[model samples]
Target: MSITARLLRYFAFFWILFLCAGTIYQYINFKHDTYFIHLKQTAVATGWYLPAFYCHIFGSSIILLAGFFQFSKTVYNNRPLHKALGKLYVFGVLFFAAPGAYVMTLFINRGGFVFASFFIQNTLWVIFTLSAFLLVKNGKIDAHVKMMHRSYALAFGAVMLRFYIWLFMRLGIGVDFENNYIIISFLSWVPNLILVELINRYNKCPYRTLQN
Candidate 1:
């Protein structure tokens, strides 16, 4: 890896760890009203929201950590371990994380656009992840790798959403919280997927030529 790629890898690793740690600490008490939950008391009252919230939080955390290592040369060389982690990541997203996110989207009241953004994001997340699993099952390794990259790009949106929120706040770009959230809702995942596409193009990923 080039120095820049190495640096980005380290940065991403530490950033994910930091976010996961914060999420764990925030919900360690399992309280009904806490952090973001505190803002969604109405949603919490629905009885379904809290369970879905926990599912998304805990499930996404596992997949986030596991998926990050999916790109590691060391882990990739260890076929058994890589396959194990891939299974964990796929099942975690399909069964727990993505489904939970889908449920949560129904409760979003941040206007139709914001809701649309999240709904679309969750939908694509499932599609990409499922495609990755199916492609690998069919022994299409290159396509599987491409799809996995797309899947994790959306997965990383959880991190990017929070990062952008913090960044916007610090930069004083969007003072209105509601409008700011609306912007970040799309910003979080769109750029991630676009960047992944650009990277695949630069690397001449086989999936691109296959599509062409």
Candidate 2:
């Protein structure tokens, strides 16, 4: 493989591993932590919270796990399974995951900026997914693919959040971690979309092409 390809492969592997491990750690810790349990219980006391939590957790997990697969060019070219998975992914994000994220955002403790960042992310996530679905429905495959890529890039914030924390902690900066999280809430995805924009530019792929 070329050096760039090799670097990308290594990055992808490490990213996927770190994401899986960190999320598992967080979930396990959440299960044992009295604070999280109490918060969950409180959320459950309200009728919408429990369902939102479940959808957010399960749907996000599934999206993260399945998202990497969608990036494979080979899989995109494969008609049957690809379309089926794409439909399922869109449904999961739109009907369950994104809505759940919006509902859960009301309870975020990172104060206004962080909550607003996530609220925006959730909104954009739904828009990206819906746009991708509409493109495919209209037989615009390239637009569908690019839009779905943007959608998955937003979903990758969960992975990037932990990655940034690890970076700051390892750097031994004395800054307050909570403040760092506030920054990361937005930083995690803004650069992602920028990277996507660069890719589209380099590839000369218009966001939505019309070939009349």
Candidate 3:
């Protein structure tokens, strides 16, 4: 990779790691009250919420870091390692992250709009991830790569969700907390998927590998 490309890749990798680390830190003590301040009522009301929350948190963090390396030429060339990480990423999303997100969607206290946003996003994440796994199994490498890109885009929404929440708070956008959250619920994943689609289109040339 060119120096610029390498720098950008490392930047993104570390940025994702930083976000994941910060999120994991919040739950380091495994206390139900740590990040569940607002969801305490829901947690008490539903027996499944805490389990789903932990699954999504830890599972998504592992997949986010693993998925980043999926695009690396070095990793891609190492078939055993690539397949191992691919399985990790796929299973992480399908069995843990996506399922957990689906369960959590049921408990979203935000209005229907926010709930719908998360439901759809989570649905797409599962579909894209499953499709990628199936495609690779069938030896459809090119299509598999494309679908994996889409899957990872949705996965990155976790980080984007937090970043947007922080940004909105800093910029004083959508001053109402409920309204702000509603906006962020959609903002989190839509733009990431759109950007991924644009990148896929721009790099459609057969000679252009995803690693580039």
Clashes of each: 0, 0, 0
Candidate 2 local lDDT, residue 95 = 82
In order of TM-score, best first, we have 1, 3, 2
Q: Give lDDT tens digits, candidate 1, residues 122-195.
A: 99999999999999888777888888999999999999888887889789886366577888999999999998
For model 3, how does the per-residue alpha-carbon lDDT over 1-212 read when each residue is reduced to its tens digit?
A: 68987896776787798888987898867776664545466555678887888899899999999999888778987778988999999999999998888888888777899999999999999989999888777767778888888999999899888778778878878435657788888888998899889878888624233331
Question: lDDT score, residue 106, model 2?
Answer: 81
Superposition TM-score, candidate 2 onto the true structure: 0.82
For residues 21-133, write the lDDT of model 2, one tens digit per residue: 65566664445354554766666567777678767766777777676776666665666767767777888898888888888888777689889899988898999999988
lDDT of each: 0.87, 0.75, 0.83
Error of 1 at 11 (Å): 2.2
Assess the local accuracy of residue 150 in candidate 3 as a C-alpha lDDT between 0 and 100.
94
TM-score of model 3 vs. true structure: 0.89
TM-score of each: 0.92, 0.82, 0.89
Q: Candidate 1: list runs displaced more than 4 Å.
A: 174-178, 204-212
Which candidate number would show the highest lDDT if scored against the true structure? 1
Candidate 2 versus truth, CA RMSD in Å, comes to 3.8
Best by TM-score: 1
